[model samples]
Structure formats: structure tokens, C-alpha cells
Target: MKKYKDFVCVGFAFALSTVSCEAKNDAKIHVSQLGYTPNSDKKAMVVPDGKVDSFYLCDAASGKICYRGKLSPKKYWDLSGEDLQWADFSSYDKSGEYYLSVGGKKSYNFTISSKAYDDLTLWAHKTFYLWRCGIDCTEEFSNFHGQSYAHKAGHPDVNVIVHPSAESAGRKAGSTVKSPGGWYDAGDYGKYTVNSAIALESMLMSAEAFPSFYKNFDMEIPESTNNTVDVLDEAMYNLEWMLTLIDTVDGCVAHKVTTKRFVPMVLPAETNVQRYMIGKSTATNYGFAAIMAKASRLYKNNPDYPDFSEKAMRYAKRAYEWAEKNPGIIFHNPDSIGTGSYTARFPEQFRFWADVELYLATKDKKYIDLTAIDTFQYDVPTWQLPASFALMSLIVGVENNMVDGDLKKKTELHFDKLANLLYDRMEKDPGRFPLFKFEWGSNGGLANAGTILLLQYKKTGDKKYLKAAQDITTYMIGRNATGYCFVTGFGQKSPMFIHDRRSTGDGIAVPVPGLLAGGPTLDAIRDCDTYVYNYDHPKSEYPTREYPARAYNDEICSYSTNEVAINWSAPFLMLLAGINENSK
Candidate 1:
């Protein structure tokens, strides 16, 4: 049977080779434009229009075939209607520039090295600094990006008015509060506490998990000389902004700070509108407590901010107490408002995370009792479902024996189940990533899935988990259905037109570097009238909107598909950091 199959494949290749001359100059081959690590599993996806039973890995400078490998059996996927085969070259370990060649098509040049992703990781990390709000330090940015990337400090937000929905006896509707400084939540200029909570935790947790990787990591920010690591320093910019959302009189937290409606597509400083401190909610309060507790623990002994740990913990406890008193208060946008609504209808997930972080910070059994880990769902986390933060943190604590023995066993079991599910998904999918259903912000889901697999690899030292995570990296960089690298400013074919207001209005040819565009989604067609269905291809040959993986439109108006968000960027940064730290 094996010999017969080989004969059939050879015959197919022979018949397909005759028409290979008719192929277009641009072929349907997908590879990681950024390259791969030397010792990792490396494969490229081929569409195989005709004549491709094998592939050659040739040295880019010498034009010599370093390795030749067979293509896997043809497979079909619903994500895109393309028949695909894998070119396995895991045995090639040379460290140099190379390209893949099939019957008549050649891929873009890629590299293999121990430090393949170092520059990507650094550039992506610096995006957080560039996204900083209410700060005027474009000189530092200009120096780093090698050009003038300047914008006036926007949304100072010193005297923000309290809205009717958030009014209390202590802080009335007509009153004002000083709420300033935070990364914009998305393409819009709103600052949402609920969304910022998950974003902040992703950064702080990444720093905690890989302390040595971040030590002395110079991000070229103004705070690089502050004696603290740059990740923590960048996080502090948002942390101080979050601190202003807490109502000191009664410990209630505002849900968001935003203008009544989205401002026009202009630079941050050009939007002249009154910003309001919006509704109060149990969800936002719990989110604030969780982040503050985690921050308190991560910065406990740092020399630069001697009092931050204590002060953060104090506010955390107060916010936690307030949420405990008002457990049923959920947030909804008022009838008059039309900005982004990060509504959290159920507060239990936030409560679970806050309990875990507070327990870790204080070693209090009371907080532990409130966290019902046995009943908690171990879904891969998003801003909407955040119990994964508690699960990941608990596993870290268990490794250090900081928690009880029984709790450790339960966490191990939960994490192991999640890891196995992710591995199975990757093994089954032709794209080699766990993302199949292209919901809004599907690329963010890809990043979170990669993060979990990397963490599992770290905990168990399993090469399978590492390989799965690396495959996800390939998908994001270029090896996928759309044939476009989803990250801006880093690939041969990347998103040049992302749905970011500042990037659109900044008068720059290039969008901000390192921002991950929310990749393809069929759902965007219904939401956006300006989404183009195809790019530089006949509609019959490449139907972008019909397939989930190819549904992306790189238009500035396609917010559902092309927008960049803080929560999405956070886990993506974590995923990139993990790849650089572990792939070596």
C-alpha cells in the first residue's frame, strides 16, 4: 500500500508539472517571513496549484539546495477552500538565510537562528510605550523609530465630570474627578477600566513568569533609566491612570472614562471634547482590585518605587471590600452615551481572579475561600472570560509551594486538561493553530492560545507543547490562509491600513509599528460597509469574504477586522516574549 501511494503521488506530480509554466509570478506558498529558530520544528504550507510533491530548502546567497523533503498528503480545510500540503524540514539545522522552492514557485527569504525573534519581540514590546496616553515624550519615540513620530500629549483629563449613572452621595453627577493617563482602549479614544484590567494583568504576569528574560531589558522608553525593568516601567504608566479611577471616598471604581461619542478620526490632541467619568460597577471594582493586588505582589521589593507596593495593596483591599458590598452591580452604557461599552454582566470571573491575587499578596485564607476553583471554568482567557488568570497564577504559586498541597493538585489537573486540548486542536487543524472560528478579534484568540501552550511547555518541559506554540508563531507571522502577516510593519506583506484613529490621522506613511491587527472575520462584512472583498486578485480565484480565514480587509474603516486594541496587544506581547524565551 505504501509503494502504491508513492507511485500515485509521483504520477500526480508528473502530470501537474506540465502546467507549472502557466502559474503566476506570485505563488500560493505560505512561510514565516520573520523566520524560525534553529532547533525548532519548521514547516511551510503549500497551496499546490500544480506540480509539487516535494520542496527544496536552498541557501539564499549560494542558490544551493541544502535539503529536500517530501510534501505531506493533501488535506482540505473549511477555513479556506484550498487543498494544502506541508513541507516538513525539521531536520535542517543550518543557521542562515534561506527560501523554499517547489516545482516552479519560490517563497520569500527567511532566516534560521537562535535569536530569530529578538527584533520582533523588542519592537512589539516598544508599542506599549508608544501607545502611552496623556504623555508628551515624542523625542524618545523619534530616537527609537529613527524618525519623527510625534503627537501632542492628548486627553490630560484632569477635571473629568462625573456622569449621572455613576453619581453617588459622596460624588454627585455635577461633580468632577481627576482621572488621567491610560492607553486608549481601542481605535477609539476611550479609557475603559474593565478592559484595561486584563491588559495590565497580561503584562504583569508575563514579567512575573519570566523575570530573568525581562531583567535589564531596555525598551528605549524614558523610564529605561529608572532602575526598574522596562516592562514594569511601561505598565506603571497605565497603573497610575487606573489609580485615578478609584473613588477614594467610598472605594467605588468607575467603569470607563470617555467622551459622550467617539471623536473624529484625528490626532489625539485634535479631539476637543468633554470626557466623562462613567458608570460604577461591581465588575470594574473587582477588576481594579485584582490588578492592584497583582501589581502589589510583582513590585513588592523593587527599589525604585518603595511605597507603590503598600499603597497598591491598600487600594486593592478597599476596592475588593466595595465589590463585596455591591456584588450585583453590573455596568451598562447609559442611554445618552455612544462610545465603546465594555459591559460585564457577571462579576464572578473578576471575583475569582481578584481572590486569587489578593490571597497571593496577603496569604489570607479568607480570599481563598471565596475562590471556588473546583467549579471555575478553565477556558482560555479573554477580557470577557478571565478565570484563566487565576488558574495560571495559581499554577505559579503551586510550583513554589506557596499554596496548599490539595489546591496544587487541582490546578495541575486543570492546566493539564487545557494544554492537551490546545495540542489536539493544533494537531487536527491544517493551519497548525487552534484558531478556527474567526470571531471578531480572532488573532487575539490565537495569541492567547499560544501563550497557554508556551506556559504548559514551561511547566512540563514537553517538546510537543513547544512545537505547537511555535506553529502558532508561524501562523501569525505569515503561514496562513490570507497570505498576509497580521502584524503591522514587520513582514513582506503586512497590514498597512489598520483601524487606528491616531495612525490614520498622524500624517505618517507607516502605521505605528508592532500593533497586531485583528485578523480576518466574516462578521465584519455585516458590520462595515467599506470592507473590500478582495485585494489584487480575481474574485473567483480568491474569495476573501466567503472563507473565515480570508475574510480580512485591510481597510481603515473595517474596525471589526483591522482595529488594534490594548487587550489584544497585551497577550500578543506575552506570546512573543514566551517564544523568544523558550524557543532557544
Candidate 2:
């Protein structure tokens, strides 16, 4: 009899459970016969417990699973202590795995077979479909004019659900209204989040999220997922949408529907020319920079702008240079390191994509140097500082022979390690990763998304890439489930809830109302059924009006705007489309 010591540790996604211990200290363990239970034992490796049913004895290190007699048991052996071969671990390792914890039951499904690749492609397409236009297949109706107009039905900006008081720092929904009713129809701005940017980003990133974007010689790579791919292909789709608003000098975005001959150069979310949603477009234009570079690289094949690459690079370079030059305003000044709080600070941080975009556009070392792989003065792991950028640098560095084999391996490991290190914070913290109060939703999905993209982009290992997106998406959707219905919906203690931006002029008031669930709130509800104290506090009674939800929250709003209802239920509608579709 061999007994393993009781090891205690958390497994993936912080699923806490107990493992069994079987002790046989003096047994001579021979390496040659290192199969699971080489002994011809008849008795089952049973550990009687309160609710114990079946068990398996196996070699811990080699993953050689064995039953009492010969082969592994047909019954799924609930192995403990992270034994890779506890039950169908090989299958789990081989295929695309999905193990979502529902009602505390750890059920898993996988995609396998030689056609496993095809299956994954199909699965990917299905998911893409789900998110592309949601379950309603509303893609055709989701024209730019629809949502931007707000008054129109089938608006793409459907997720904009905000608290009654959150519109003007808990003041009023609009500048004039003393009460909450009549926003979209009243022609009174019903404040929104920066939905246009994300919508555009989604379109661009979608195109290049898969390996098919790059031409592969050895393997017959699949083609793009068509329109679904374009939805996320931040490179082209997002770029084109972005071009629609680039007449601005520095830059201006479109927050609402406008039929005007000429739109003003202002933050799209915050503009006065349009009598649409009154969203704040000011402060921290820097946040969108990272994704801008990412989209630029992903869609390098086609740039809508004349020398789009150069313009993007120029924008990023000029922006940073300006930030650095305006040190006192952007950074520390009177306080010494002085930026006590990130409330108003617009961090001009760079990621690997930033430098790569510049390099891909112009092979200049000067641009390469701008890729800060070193820590910033006010360094912290959460900021992702230079580490996040390092992931991109690894590929560029290897290509440029900047680092040797061993060094490359180290860089690869460090890149992964840093991501893990950041994820560790989120895992340990119970909910969100360590974030700057002023940072808001920026750090929410970034670490996970960054980690996933980093690993996926570095190595064409679809598992890392897919897993990253799925997990983050799960977190996003889960928030909606018990909360708004998407696991990662709005960050609310209750389903009928909203967040207030406390730090600077910027806050959840900006993102929350704008119909985008965003990275932060999605992360908080990724796992649990409710918010931190949701159990204690009863759910807000359906709100005089409530947010849209996934399979849940089918109830129509008596007062809620169509966009808010859409944002509320979009993620849920999107995630469930597969189960509903595949079942059919």
C-alpha cells in the first residue's frame, strides 16, 4: 500500500476541495515498474467518507491511472491533489476543455478526435456567432445609425444601464432634468459609456484573434470566420470605424447618432454638438492607446487612413512625448513621486503591441527603445508596467536576435510568470486583480486578456488563447448570471445596482451608463452567483426598471431605455446562443 501525504492548495479558478491520503512509507518504489498500482491488488483503493462513492489509486508523478485490478476504472475517479490522471485527464489535456462550476458541481466537456481541430473551428465560429449579433441575430439591424441614434430600435448600444442617480455624479440624469424619466425620447442626453470605442475594437480584434490571420506555410490554416471575424478584427473593422471620426486634430470620437454635416473633434462619449447621450469624453484618452496599437498590428494588411500605421504610431509617440513633457500635470510634481492618487493621472503606459506597431511600420531602434521593458518610477505589478509590454518584446526580440535561445526561453517564462503573478493577485484577492482606484475598469479584463493574448500570440497554442478569452468571457458572462445575468456584467452588489466613479471626474458614471458592461464589473461576477455582500442584502426588487440579463431577466422594462436593456442582456443572450443553437 502506498500512501500519499495530504497536500493542501487551491486548484484552477480557486475551486477549494479536499484530497485523500494513502500511506505506505516503506514500500520500495521501483522506477522500472512505474505503472499506476503495479501491485495485483483486488481490493478497491477506498477511502470511506461522509459522501464518498468511488476512488482510484495511481502513480502521482507519471499519471499512470489504475483501478483495483488492471485498467483504469470506467467510473470517473474523483482524484485529489492535482493528479493529472485522476479522471480522463489525458482527454482533458488533449481537447478543448470547458469546466464551468455551476451549483458547486464540477462538470466538464471536451472537444476531441482527429477532427478535433475542425470541431474547435466550428466551436469558435459558434461562439463568434453568439457574440457577433447576440442570440437575436440582430447584426443586420445593428447599423451605426441605429445605436448611435439612441431613439432607434435594435441599437447596438443596448447595454447602457445606469443607476437613476449616477448620471450626474448622483445629481441628475441630465443637466436640466431634476428626475430620472425621459432620456432617449426626451432628446435629453441619457449618458452612455464609451461603447463606440469597444464596439469598434471588437470589430477589429475579431478579425485577427485566430491564427488564420497569419499566412502559415506548413499547415492549411483555416480562413477567417467571415463577418464574425471582422467584428473582432480590431485591425481593419475597428480602424475603419475609427476613421469615421478622425477629422479631429488630436482625436475625437462619436458617442451618439449624428446626422450633422460635420462633427466636432471631441471625445466621442462627451460631445455637445449632438443632443444625444451626455457622456464624458474628457480625461485619460491615454487608456485607448494600448488597444489602438494592438488593432493596428492585427490589421496591418489594410489601414483605412492614408499611412494609417504612421498616423497611429505618430499619435502614440506624440501622446507619450507630450505626457512626459507635461510631467507636473500628468505625473508627480509638488507631492514628490507626487501623484498620490491616479484619480486624474492619465498613464501613458506602453504594451508590446505599441512598439511592435511602430516597428512593423518603421524598423527604427528609436521606436524599439520606446518599448519600456523596465519598470516605471512608480512601479507596481498591477500597473503591468513594463512586464505586459515584455510579452510582445519577446517575439520582436527573438526575431531581431536581441536575445539568445536561453535568454528567449527565460523571456518566455518571465512573460508567462508575470501574467501568472498578476492573475495570482485577482485569485487571491477573491475578486478583482490589484488595480489603481483611478485605474477604474482599465485593469479589469486586461491582465487575463493580456495573459491570454500574450500566450496565444507568442505560441500558436490555441488552448492558452482560447482559454484566456473563454475564461475572461466567462467572468464577463458570469457577472450577468446572478448579477445582471452575464457572469461578468456590471459590478453590482445586487442585480439592481450601479457603480459610482469616486476617484476623479471620471468614474463608473461614465462607463456604467454608456451601455458597455466593460472589463471591471465583468471580472467581479465572473465566478460567484452574487456580489460580495449580495447574500446579506436582498436583490433590489426588479428596479422600477431593471437591466437586461442572459437566459434570465427576460422581463421587459416599464421605464428602462432600449440600449440599457440590450447591454443588460447582450452577454447572456450571446453566451447561451450556442447551447440553444447546438441543441437544435
Candidate 3:
């Protein structure tokens, strides 16, 4: 055969353009509950033990009542008007769990599980529902995706997978951008890899997690059934096709899948640059393989869709092997994490939805430990860093089936402290905390907050988690923008923990500005209380594109499966499933 590898090397520029490794100093910031923030996690001052009168949350910083709600002396009491002593809601306890206020019954008695805020669980449910409803977010995204795409229970944003920018411009550019900068379907910004992989897995997860929906196609192939299977099918096709372009290139996804649109473009996989194809870019390809492996593991005897599991596993293994060898930038390692451009150490831990499937399929210890987060970091005498990876590490310990007993305890405590702190921030200022706090935005940020809270709830089974989830959902649904959330700023800096060490002493990571993805946020809020969204969020005066429109950031067009597939569509599908299942 004429050397196929020769064509790739000649056709593409097979080199990476990494950001200069000039030592970028990490930012020094103060957050309480990094276990022992000297000024942070101190207990709130209280009245004399014998006294019983006013019930309220007193903020130590301001020495004022942050919030006041009636309480009962009982472990779980009724919401009686006469009751006055209320337990203060704080992340100090646990998160992702919540309770409903039942009249004269249980105060904190209404328990929502830690998984109440789970991204995978809730979004999977929503995406399934959207699939059932027949108008997926991807269809809506096409309005911003530049080119139109067919939509039926879809991960609609799929068609534009490699497209650079889904341009939304002029005064119509609306929010999600700074000064309504020229919108390029190829050039706005976002977190591509992790979020997209999660979304991608959600597609398979719908089929696997709730076989009734995805696998149901085998039985009740409806006349108009174009579920995410189509989406994934196409994704696989495009993915395999894209491999042609990647043979020599170090790290980069094609500009777009459309034959015409991105025929001549490819860029380095920089943060906020090339379409967001983070760890999942490679991880997704592998994850798909893993999914197939899972299907194979399950369907080995079933002859119908026989090879899916096997093929999927093979693909996953190959991808993993490639990642180990290439080590392309992302959560592959911790040292490079704050370095930006996507990095997470030991993400295999905490049962990341993707890793979880593979672990479930193979029952591999290594994969489970992929979910393992390092508690050893806790022993290091340093500032408490609570990045997503750290959270994963904490989760690993809490869920540890294997590991030294002491390490497990230490891990659980670490998570406890983190959860407690997050809870406090949520209660204190659910709006401002978490930078990616529970709010309106296209970044699927609220979904992130919701998921994190749900993670906490699952861990501790504490009522505070339910409260956090409830509060976030309450705030979100109360705003009701027809499931669309908006914010300002896309191009300030990577939303991850590290701040820029810009040589110019003045220009730090400037915050850009606004739009929201309808899928993820709605799914997240729905996880807590579906009743919250009686009134939907309106279509923005400006277009849905340009969400979190940061001034200086570049856009990562189609590679962002988070915005397109998983976060956007999976939630709808999942929600639909929950609705139908319950209604049935």
C-alpha cells in the first residue's frame, strides 16, 4: 500500500505550539475551610447555651444575620411558625442533599441524596427526555452553530464538532461576550475536553444507564426516532475520519467536520483557543471504545449488537495507551494542571462517569483508581487547593473499596472539609462563590456546581447538601429565563484556579462577559426541583451565542462536546426519561 503515514505528514503541520513555559507564578488567594484556614472555618459565635430566642445565621466577617429562618428543636421538625431555633445551613456539614419544608413535620427531614445534584445522573435523565420530546438542544444550538443540522433526540451540536466559531454578531450578538465582539463560530472560548467527554459519555450512558431509552431502539423503533444513537454514530464516523488529519499532528482537532467550512484550518490545542477538546478529545475517542467494551461486556452473549462492547473496549484501550505515550495537555497530570490547557491528576478516581463505565465494564482496579484522588496531597503542608481534581481525590477515598484504611479515612475527612466549605459559600453567597458558581452561563457552570453539590450529598448524606442543591435550583428556577442562563465574560483567563502572571503587572485575567446553554443549567436545576421552572427563561434580547463573552479570549468552536452533546443534550434526555418513567 502507498504509505498512508506519508500523506498525513505531508498534508498537515505535525507540530504543537505550546505556551511558553516561562515560570508563571501561581496566584495567592485566601479561601476558608482549606481544612484550617486560620481566619476561615472558625465556628460562628453563638449566644449563651441556656438562652433560646432568636434563630439566625450570623456571619463572622460582618457580625450580622446572613439569613433567618424558623427552626425546630427536634432532629427533624415541622416548619411551624412557632418554632424559632433553626440550624444554620453551611457546607460545614455536607452538600448535594436537600429537604423540602414540610409544614409542622420535619424541618431538615426532607432528604435528597448526594446524587441529587449529580451531573451524570440528572443530565442523563434530562437528555433522554429531550430525546423523547423531539427538539434537542443541538437543534437550538444550530441556530448558533452556523450551519443547520438535523435534530431528533440529538446531540445537535455534533455537526459543528470541528467548526471554529459559531458566530453571533453586532447588537444581536447579545450577551456572553464583551462589547459584542465579532462572533466567529470558530473563535469563542470554553472548556472543551472534560466537559465534552462527560457529555459524550452521557450519550452512551443514556443507552447503558437506562437501557430502556437507548437500547429501546432495538424494540420500538418509532417512525420518527432519531435519538443520540444517530449523534454518536455520526460522532464515531467523524472521529474516525478526523484521525486521518491527526496522524502526524501532535495535538489538534480539525477546524470543523463540514467538508467546506474547515478544509484548511487547524490550531494548537490552547486553552480558550482551538475548540475546547480537552482531555476528552482523546479521552472521548477512548471512552467510546470503553462504552463499546461495556456493551460487549454486557452483550457478549446477545448476538444482535455483538461487537459493540468489544470494539468499544479495544478503542478505549488504544486511546488510553496513546494518551500515556503522548501525554497531550490536559488532566493527565496534576503538575501541568494549574499550567492550564486542561490538566487533572488521577481523574480515573471518584468514579468519573467515563472512568466509571470502563471500571464497571472491566472491574479493573487501575480504572477504579483512575477515579482515585490523592489524599497524600492533604499531608503536604500547603494552602488547600480545591480544584476539580482535588474533589475527585476526596471522592475516591470516600468510595474506596481498596486502599490503606488510614488513607481512606484521611481522604474522607479531606472531602468532608471541602464539602463543608463549599456548603458555607453556597449558603453565604451561592451567587459569588465557586467562580463557576451556580448561576446563568453557557459554560454549563451551574451544572458544575450542581454536580459538585450532588457529589457531596452522595458522600455525606447530610441535609446541607440537599439545601445547597435546593438553593442553587431555587435561585436558578426563580430566575426562569426559559432554561437559558446568561453571564458576561469569556476571555478573562481560564476559569480554573490559577491566575495569570502577565508580565504587564496590570493586566491580570480580565473577566469578559455572557450567554447560557439551555441544556446543562436546566438539567442541573431540575435535579433538585422540577417545579422550580414553572416560567421558562426567555430567548435573550441578543442571541444565545456569545455566552460568557470575554473580550480577549479565542473561541474553541465545535470541539466542545460539553456545550453540544453531553451537558447540552444529555440533561434533556435524562430529564425526559425521569419524567416518563415517573409518569408511567
TM-score of each: 0.92, 0.42, 0.40
Better of 1 and 3 by lDDT: 1
Best by lDDT: 1
Global lDDT of each model?
Answer: 0.81, 0.29, 0.30
Q: Rank the candidates by TM-score, best first.
A: 1, 2, 3
Clashes of each: 0, 47, 101
Please write out the lDDT profile of model 3 over residues 71-186, one tens digit for every residue: 33422111111112223333222222222112211112111233322322232332222222112324443221133222333112221222222121111111121111111111
lDDT of 3: 0.30
Residue 462 of candidate 2: its Cα lDDT? Answer: 38
TM accuracy, model 2: 0.42
lDDT by residue for model 2 (139-244), tens: 3422222322111122233222322222333323333311111112111122222232232232332233223432221111121433223223322333333333
TM-score: which candidate is best?
A: 1
Give Cα distance to truth, residue 58, candidate 1, Å: 1.9
Task: Give per-residue CA lDDT, model 1, range 157-236, as digits (tens).
Answer: 99899999888656789798888788888888999999899999889888877776898577888878888889899998
State which candidate, 1 or 3, has the greater TM-score: 1
**Residue pairs of candidate 1 with colliding backbone atoms:** none
Candidate 1: segments with Cα more than 4 A from true spot: 1-27, 143-145, 530-543
